[model samples]
Target: MAENSSSTPPGTPPEDSRPRPQYGELAPEGWSWTPTPDERTLATPDAPVSSAAPVAAPHPRGTAPRWDRPVTLSLLVLGLLSTLFAVSMLAMITDSIQLIYTQLDLGGYEPDPSVPGLVTAGIVSVCLVWLATAAGAILLLARGRRAFYVPLIGAVLFVVVFIAFSSAVLATDPTLLNDPNLMDVYGSL
Candidate 1:
């Protein structure tokens, strides 16, 4: 029979340079080539046991995985941008409210026929609510568990508000479309 040259010397592994078993493959006395549990039963009683340490079962990915850098950074950046946009919307609404109050005080300005005062108030209230929700979403992202979804929901709300606000402004002030700056940009394009 061919000699079992593969068998390691029966003692501590050689002090000379050699690869050490990383997982639970080496026992105190000698090397253990015991078949994995799925493949076969334990080695015969006379056969040298490979390892006294129990074989470690493979772990499922993501059970304790670290957050990937790119994904986490992307989500964080999105959340921050969403929050900033919501704040800007709130500021615009507040500024418009102030302008309306000033015009009413002067008794020389009138609300647009196409955009009623009630609709403007409603738009302002909606913007405030969006800002609050976006702030909450940004704060919740620190938990890192299903937090990215909050910002996504805020983004949808932002889109709805943006469309409604734009339509109202365009309906009330079609002349704004003729601004020299806008014409210049379009002409350049």
Candidate 2:
């Protein structure tokens, strides 16, 4: 028996097959490798695709493809810097709890309170969202996507997330509402 060119080998699937998405990954499960209608065609019958063909780029090249313009590179650098800052804040979250307790002590509050998981959850969630935002923007930047609005959208998302988490933190903690001193500190924050 003879095999047609269209027949995949018995032992292995073709390289063009779609992959299963990971848990929490942005790609939807069951997504196929087939190119979407919105995407540009990779190759033409007249010309085969080469390694450089992808980066050779079209005009404006959508967002900030590095080879096409300096803006993407600039955004990459800024995103990295902001990532570092956000990571530092995440690193310092534990210390902030100690500081919060100390302030409560200075205000003549009695015994030390064990840290609240709600507050911790809120803080960590906010930081993780921030990191995720930066990471998403960076990923888009690397992929040569038209991603100028990704970071902008991420910033807005951060504020909204912060507000939601902050409200939860406040609402759950009665001490913040009962004591004027704690309220002042929370308000300052």
Candidate 3:
């Protein structure tokens, strides 16, 4: 059997006779068919689509794409720097603790029974906690997750620790504030 060129398949019209939408016309309600680039090219008689058209790789569900932009790069860098800084602060804290003990043992220096040891312990504990927080932030960035919130939390913790320690020191001995060296550091006695 031979098919007639003039006869179209049921529900389909000849290509040239199909209605063309005007520039600002609204599409029909309930079903709007927007052709993809490949489909458009295939439909055009003169423009045959090549078999080598590029296909985008499908992403795995539940995971967001890792951005290669400057903002993400800078965030990773900041996380690394924060981790390094925390490590350095931890080292400094250890040194401060050692120096305090050394002075008491070798320099014949006597601090108040409970205050100096308590202050030293507090400083060491705060540094260790901050170090852990910074490490966690770095890990989150490495895993392609948002990480700056961790460091922000650490900063707020630092503020609280500073205020607590400063108040404690002042309560123990307000005379330290009267010293000219400390006054220069603090801007007021």
Every model: Cα RMSD to truth: 12.7, 22.0, 10.5
Q: Which stretches of candidate 2 lie over 4 Å from their true place?
A: 1-115, 178-189
Please list the residue runs of candidate 1 whose C-alpha ends up more than 4 Å from where it truly belongs after superposition.
Answer: 1-83, 86-145, 176-189
lDDT of 2 by residue, 46-67 (tens): 5665766365546564455444
lDDT per residue as tens, model 3, 1-189:
455666877777546544676543656667567789998988778855669977666656533354523344464456456545544553354354445445434333333466556566556656665676668766766666666567667667765765565456445543342335544444663
lDDT (0 to 1) per candidate: 0.53, 0.56, 0.56
Q: Estimate TM-scores for all models.
A: 0.34, 0.40, 0.40
Residue 78 lDDT (model 2): 63
How do the candidates rank by TM-score, highest first? 2, 3, 1
Backbone clashes, each candidate: 1, 1, 0
In model 1, how many backbone clashes occur? 1
Best by lDDT: 2
Report the candidate with higher TM-score, 1 versus 2: 2
